[model samples]
Target: MNVFYEEDGGFKVGAVLADNTTSLQVEAPHGKRSKIKAGTVLLKFEKPALSEFMEQAQHVADELDADFLWECSNQDEFGFADLGLEYFGHAPSTVEAAGLLIKLHGSPMHFYKKGKGHYKAAPEESLKAALASVERKRLQALQQAEYTAQLTGFSCPEALLPQINMLLYRPDKNTIEYKALEQACHDTGLTPPKLLEKCGAIPSSHDYHFNAFLFEHFPKGIEFGEIGEFDIPQDLPESNVSAFSIDDATTTEIDDAFSLIHLPNGNWQVGIHIAAPALGFGPGSRLDEIALERLSTVYMPGNKITMLPDALVNAYTLEATKSCPALSMYLEIESADYSVVSSVTRIERVKIAANLRHDTLEPLFNEDTLARGGPDYPFKKELGILWELANRLEIGRGKQGSNIGTDYSFVVKDDRIAITDRKRGNPIDKVVSELMIYVNSRWAKMLSEKGVAGVFRSQFNGKVRLSTTPGKHIGLGVDQYAWASSPLRRSMDLLNQRQLIALVRGEPAPYASNSEVLLGAVSDFELASEAYNSFQRNMERYWCLRYVLQEGINEASATVLKENLIRLDTLPLVTRVPSMPELPPGTQVQVALSNVELLDLAFGCEFKHRIELQ
Candidate 1:
């Protein structure tokens, strides 16, 4: 006898070789024998061969209407033979019974299986809902196929227009749009960004990179919301000195400046004035909250997101011709040796005499000019005296003979970029850096002595860290260094400025000793600043590549750092050239640029020849 049975949820036919009471040894249609349980067998027939049974049954099942069969069945459960008998109006044949069983098994929405060879009709409501869902999924599959086809042909479906950014940056894999995009990307052998660009979805490379940063960091967008009005006290004490600031020409938020007063007691009193925006806004204030969210000014090649609003920066910035409130550090020193006799901190309004620009000042006042004693300029005497003190301070820090490299400044206007160079440890830089270092170190000392908590910068073994407690900063060769300057640009500096102001006034400090708030701020700022700095460096590198292509210069000089990685001399771009020969560090070589991909910000170069070892 031939037997029809269910195995692993599918119908199969076999020839029964030896029948036992509970089981049978059977050979399948393809001649493979297996021992199967008698309960699993649905039918036994004598006329049809085992191979032809399933084919004929499937043909009959294909001809029968599953819905009609479901409607014809009893309301309760019934066997397939009973249903088949009622449908055919006689004792059904094996093919009819098997076909009906297969039809009922396949249409799960019309009929639900109760047991082997038996099923119950689905309720009208459940059947209708299931049918509708099946139809919906069928339509979605068709639509997804069409979208994928369109994308493969370099056409973007309109449905993807509004979701392109999300699809590119943050994708939801469950959605059909993302699935179609993923499939299309696989077909085209390109990344999502590149494929979309090919389909003309993203046209601008600049916008692609810029939007990537915004999507990750500034998801809601970089806009300042409504801010409450603030009051700056008009009764701040006025000072006698006219302080002048030295900064770049693009600087609007002048943070620090200098003034000199020749004392009648034969000593020189030098004033280090820092713009005091902290006095106008305290912690938990509107401006303070704004600064905290941003943490610091995010600087790219030519653009920046200022921590404070422009109006606030203008009110606090020490611009020339305006006497702005300042946190002044007065150092009374001997005129002969520039030794600090006394140092004091005070808050007052000081007249801003001038704002010096690097482009103009570096030409007239520099190392060569100072060594020659040949020429003079505005604030020349004060700059000379400050440079002397800076030398003393650098030597005191035990960092003498340090030759830091150049700092590149980028200016982007329209599609054009101008890169300029400034030596890192020049006399002008030394003056400003040394004086700021002095103030920060001194304020850190005062805060530690007064048992007040502040954010301290400490570095050891080339790893820099921030902490609430005072610690030695081996890099600066100081007891402790707390940033108390640039209140308009950096939030931590602003926070420290508030603490310093409170200490100067003999009032309660904003941050208490061992304050969790201070420590948390330090940690949060460190993370945010690292991300911001990375973005800045990436953008700078992007602009450097742009400059190279815009200028149309193919040959460039590069200095070897280790083996294959080198830094280009023309711009601050460091990349690897696989063709580079093994050379010592500081060896100069010429390289030719070939492919410059703006979208990926990748450069392809070939090492041409070596210049010299320097």
Candidate 2:
């Protein structure tokens, strides 16, 4: 006898081998044998074979109308055979009963299973809603297919234009645009950015990278609207010294400058003046809030997003010919030796005499010119005096200047670039760097002595950190150092400047010790500053490759940094040269560059011959 039974909540047919009272030993159609309970047995037939019965029942199930079956089903639960009998208007054959069971099992939405071979009809409302959802999804699948077809042909669908940033930077996988973009990427083996660029969706390669950064960092866009008007301080005592700033020609928000006064007592009074914007913008003010959100100015190869608006920067920046409010550190150094006899910090208006550009001044005043007594130039006398003091300050630090290697300044204009190479520890660099370091260290000391809290830059054991407590910055060979000079560009500098101004003016400090705002700003600035610096380095690297392609540098020399890593001689670029022979660091090797991908910001560097042996 052939029996139809349920096993593991599924229908199966097996041949009974030995029948017991309540159980049977049966062999399945595939010849596997098992003991079964009598209660699990649904039917027993003698005529048709088990294999043919299932195949014929499936055909009948295919022919059945699920909607019609659902309508014909009784509201209360009934067995499949009873429903089959009700629909067929007769006592169902065993095959017909099994076909009804198959139909009911297939249409889960139309019918819900209650017990073995027993079924219940779904409610009309739920059935309609489920059908509508399935139909909508089916239509969306068809639309996705159409969009993919358009993208496959290098044509962007109109629907994807609105979601270009989303598709490139942060895609929502559930949306149809992203689905089509993913499918197109899989088909073409091209990245989404490349595919979109091919379809003319991306206008420029520069914008592609710029927009990605903006989307992640400046989601609302880099705009400062209606932050209120800024007031330039009018009632400030003007200084006698005429100051001049040294920065790149493109710099507009000039921060630090210098001045000199010959005292009658054979001592030189030198002023390291910093543009003081903190005096204008207090904590929780509009400009302060904007500066807080920005944290620091974002710099790339050719452009920058300033922490302050142009109007405010123009007012506060120590522009030439303007008597601007500044926080000055006047150092009284004896003429016989460049030692700080005394130092004073005060807030006053200092006349900015000139804005010296590196391109113009570097030629007149450099290491060679300083050693040989330069051909006459603007601020030559003042710079020479300051250069002496800078050297003295460097000697006081117990080290030469922070000498590493070469530093490149990038200038980009209308897609053209110029990268000027300069040595790190030149006279121009030393003078500016040493004075800034001295003032930062001196002001850090003053703030600590006065019981004022300030954000200090501390380094120990090769790791750098921001802390409130005064500690030794072993790198600079200083007891403590804080950034208080560049308030026009950096928020932390602005914060420290606020504290220093309070201490110098004998006013209550703005931030209390261990205040949440102070602590949070320290940590937040570290994270934001690191991210901005990394982005600047990466963008500079991208430009280096662009320079390679533009200059057609096919073969170049590089010094080995590690096993396979090399630093190019002409460009500030580091890469892994392929198939490099084992060599020690500082061994120069010739390399061939090829396959520069701007979008990927990568280069294929091949090892040539060793340029410098052992």
lDDT of each: 0.89, 0.89
Instruction: Tell me the spans in candidate 1 whose CA falls farther than 4 Å from its real position.
Output: 73-75
Query: Model 1 RMSD to the real structure?
Result: 2.2
Candidate 2 lDDT over residue span 545-609, tens digit each: 88998899898999999999999998999999768999999898999999997778898999989
Write the residue-wise lDDT of candidate 1 on 44-67 in tens digits: 998677778889999889999877
After TM-score superposition, the amount by which residue 278's alpha carbon in candidate 2 deviates from its true location, in angstroms, is: 1.1
Output the worst ten-in-a-row residue range by lDDT, candidate 1: 224-233
Question: In model 2, what lDDT does residue 513 have?
Answer: 77
In candidate 2, position 173 carries an lDDT of 97
Model 2 regions more than 4 Å off: 6-10, 18-25, 34-42
The 10-residue segment with the lowest total lDDT in model 2: 225-234
RMSD after CA superposition, every candidate:
2.2, 2.1
Error of 1 at 28 (Å): 2.7
